[model samples]
Target chain A: MKAFEFLDEIGTVNTHTMVLDKGLGYAYVEDALKITGEYFDLLKYGWGTSILYDTEIIKAKNELYHSYDIKTYTGGTLFELANKQNKLGEYFEELDNLGFDAVEVSDGSTVIDPDIRENAIKQAKENGFYTLSEIGKKNPEKDHAYTTEQRIELINKDISNGSDMVIIEGRESGKNIGIYDEKGNVKTDEMTQIHENTPNEKVLWEAPQKNQQVELILKLGNNVNLGNINSNEIISLETLRRGLRGDTLGKIQK
Target chain B: MKAFEFLDEIGTVNTHTMVLDKGLGYAYVEDALKITGEYFDLLKYGWGTSILYDTEIIKAKNELYHSYDIKTYTGGTLFELANKQNKLGEYFEELDNLGFDAVEVSDGSTVIDPDIRENAIKQAKENGFYTLSEIGKKNPEKDHAYTTEQRIELINKDISNGSDMVIIEGRESGKNIGIYDEKGNVKTDEMTQIHENTPNEKVLWEAPQKNQQVELILKLGNNVNLGNINSNEIISLETLRRGLRGDTLGKIQK
Candidate 1:
């Protein structure tokens, strides 16, 4: 039913695009979904943004995303903030009341005991919410201290602790953070090492830049789950995955 | 009514924020404008993106933007493309049918003789369109050859030729091209020289970066006409103009 559905039929496609929705208005959510809803599966109302909106608008935006079968969740920063306030229970209750079907557990911006991190993941699952846990410090210095081996071990542990997916931190800027260099280019050696060790299906890499997205797709095949995509680039990214764009055209094969 | 109208009573604010809309869905525009429309004065369909969408959708989007009292215009690259193809007449007619009230003239990606550039500006004005003529080549290598004095000369010529406003090229990246270094920092010497010489009222600076926006506001006052702002940053830019944000807070007076 897509405009160029035949083009995508030429290859085997494996894509689970997770778009970041940072305080979208309900009308935008309603209308934008008609064009891009089918291409994305997960929607994250970006860090601490939902907290700034009224309960009514947040609820309305969540309902609209859900109407498209796009599972909606609050950003990891919100969960961290809730934990810092010792209101994790209140957070879960409020998320359910607002019709969010998932929760992101991240310690990127804060510190929590390992036991607490594991328990939060388990608790979200117990509450019938899809739990996504993130690994990597928000600060570049702290994030860089972890070797590829350490990140790999954490990804496996999070999966065993009942997280449906584990996100690797690539903040909105995507520069000098995690596997990206200062110029927003991928560190291929680190990326390859992690790719070889981690469960690809359970990991979502936040590739916010176009060059990063292109490199990830070309290196990991078209099905690599990419997160933090800007809303406007949804269609353009779809083209890259299907070899319809100049960057990936005839270069990608099933 | 704004969210924090009570806070901005300290000073008079002069700002004309122009946002770049590269093919947004009509629904998103309708919903998003409600949240941030009051902060912006112009909406530009970025560089040839309007030619990619249906004529009806383009017209509808223009109407939606105009409803918020935001003047709508196509990117100058589209004008250059049409001029290259010898379709300037058809392009103007189409823009009229699509309800666009303004047109941009530029020689960014192609060669336009000075006479043609001036005529294009005058022709657009003659066709009942508000004209915005841009100075600076799209190619950084080519753009760097022009001295600041030459740029000032072009700006004066464009205005004299009936361009309602003249834009300085910062091209979405805001780096190493016009009054910016490779790191996207403003070159103060060149900027100061141009500011001192140019007609400030008729010039729009396409500043796509936050640092650039902050610097311009600090140097030229909050009322400076700034273009190419991301849609999400409209409210944030307004806050900067009114000295409400941390960057410019308490630094400016009415």
Candidate 2:
């Protein structure tokens, strides 16, 4: 049982939290999960970092995350790399062998033909994986070129192509990307535009910063799907969601 | 043995690294220590977070750190709180019982009489604790009020009062405090003034950002003592010290 149960703030229900696991050791994940296990919905091996560690470790980490009922996936970079190498089939096979239940299909670092991107999402879904398609360029200049209308179209397109969820690219820094301004403050107009157009429940916003998390949660209700969270901030984010933290305290409506 | 031994980069030697632990669990520490334990010299329970967790957990963490030959201590805020409550003696006794081998003496959040500050350091040393004193206010405006000369005087004074090391406060943000500018850039003029005036070896710089770490490593050589390192960045910081990362690669001199 959690402390301060008398306060009776509604804890995480119908909200999805995806944490980024960037090369954390086995015992570390085990301990962190013991405290914040129920809070996480997804575990991402961030941005090609999975390739740096032994295959055994990745498989073990996948099993650990699975124990908490958290779906595991490699970052979009790995998928993009596989696509570039003409190894999409091999990539899916490798993911299956490694115990990943989800796949992120993105063209953040490299260009993918629109049809190919759609097919990847379809293929992932057909292969019994939860397909999450991302919409944004890794380069800030490239990312800024896409108008809100274009982003909305892509998000809709990806969902239509059988993506279980469409992720907005916030990157690790969460600065000057997608709907965030240079200082990481949410551009409310752009965020609202995207939210209004997209299926809000199917759209997961990659909010890495604390301020961004608070803003997104406050603006879109507690059930906002948030991703790319730092592993250490799992419990902190759960507190924010439950309105147990000062930022959202007494502000979250039941 | 560490990977990439053929590269033959000189690893950390005669340098101190102090990592912040803000309520991490036992197994987490054990796993992190197994990989990057040798890099750490001091483990600080950041701010007043220690009081928030169970005393048993704190004792276990302290023992775990000690096993890795890393000295553990509560943050200066706790010391400041003790000073405020006139429980300095009790604080020392509690630290002993908690198995902390070190203590940080600071007036960051509260005012301390210079005589009392000196006595606190002496008391900690007398109680067989490695005494660390921090300089700079927690408030940015108040911290900015101190001139370079005043900082030098305080640093020298703390050492004279038997401080094992004096930490130049950058806080966790590493911005607009001590020698860091608003953009978290190093104010080289102020940094040089303090370094030239004081015994550089006795001063540990709190640099929490990657840029700050790179700048400090390049400017002061790899042996410049750094504190307030996030637990996840331990391996990354060690790589910077060894000229393994792109930022400091081919830039660090023998």
Candidate 3:
């Protein structure tokens, strides 16, 4: 039961918010998780941050995330970096040693051939990790060049290649990339087309902004998988989904 | 000298930023302070959040803040809540007991007559706390009614009423209040007028957004006092002030 249980009477609200832990210490994560762990499902050590932190801290953080049934993964950028350096085997070993249950395979910052991107997804699966493959380039122009049809093609290919989830890249900014416009507003037509082509549960949208989250929730229902969520917004996003926030108050049926 | 000396060829820079703590535990504060304590001066537990946490936690947090030479204070809304309940005396005593060395007095949410607001400022001064009074209303329309000149008048009056600092209310949103417009852009004309009218150091602008911080730093110089900064942005903001960010890079210099 929530603090505003009366408002969300139908009571079916499970917000799958994946928080970005950008270089936070284990004790800090523990203290923070005490207040907000129940609101999230996945803990992503953003970008190459896990590679930057001590191995012990990363392992400890993974254990903490798993304690709350939160799947832990290194950011796609790290996997992409490792793949670029031909260290994918080493990366898999390091990730497994660090106790990460999942890994994000992305070519957001680097170019991996479509064939290679798909093969990497299968390789990650063979390595015994739940894989989330991301589509779209980090650079806005390159990302926008992909037609909605092309995006659907990549999404289908990744899923076929055994990706557990496909992330529509929002790249922390959620602007001028994929479905989001320059002002960070969602292009509704693109969103609908993508949703029609992809399974909603297997697709996570990186929505770092509140308006995007509100719009996505109202469009796709509360269980919409959201990623790149700042640590501060975990509770607020949950409230927004549960109709406790003023923005989504009367709109979401409990 | 700061920890990352390679980034600071000009030795180190001075910055006075007031970060919003909201409701952080002692351990979180200790860890965060260790990371960015050299960057900021004061910590504000934003808007009645201390009421949600225990007094011992608040006291310990205050001690941690003080150890880092960061003065700590309860948000103006908390003080207003006590004042509304006519327990202002007890509120001051409680703040002192909790080791708060500063107090913020504002009428952003509630209506307080000029005399009462001024008296609160004077009382905070008499109680030996560094005072930070605020201008502008929390509601957009109400805040808009205060003309630039009127805001300048209030700022001057607050300083005269014994405030150590007078903050232009941005309500953690930094939009459509005081010198900021609805899009969170600074109204330069009004900002210039306010600067012309008030004694500079007595005014601290609440700039919660990075763009706002960059704009203020560019226009007002690196030493310009800023408030209501989110805890996560402390290092990022410090970098911006020193021209390390692309936005403020090569724009401001000693």
Give the per-prediction TM-score of chain B.
0.97, 0.98, 0.95
Label model 3 with its docking quality class. incorrect
True contacts kept of 2: 0.08
Top of the candidates by TM-score: 3
Candidates' TM-scores? 0.62, 0.62, 0.63
Deviation (Å) of A3 in candidate 3:
13
Q: Can you write out model 1's per-residue Cα lDDT over B166-193, one digit (the tens) per residue? A: 8999987787889889999999999889
What fnat does each of the candidate structures reach? 0.14, 0.08, 0.05
lDDT of 3 at B22: 51
Candidate 3 Cα deviation (angstroms), residue A86: 10
When sorted by TM-score, best at the front, the candidate numbers are: 3, 1, 2
Ranking by DockQ: 1, 2, 3
lDDT of 2 by residue, B1-254 (tens): 75676876775658999998755778877877998898888998776555544466667778889998999887786677567667788788888877889999998877789999999999999999999999999778889999999999999999998999999999878988999999999998998888888888899999999999998889887888999999989989988997888998888776
Q: Give the per-residue lDDT of model 3 (tens digit) for B33-94.
A: 88888788888876645554445556777888899899989777667656766778877877
- Quality class of the docking in candidate 1, CAPRI style: incorrect
Give the per-residue Cα lDDT of candidate 2 at B105.
95
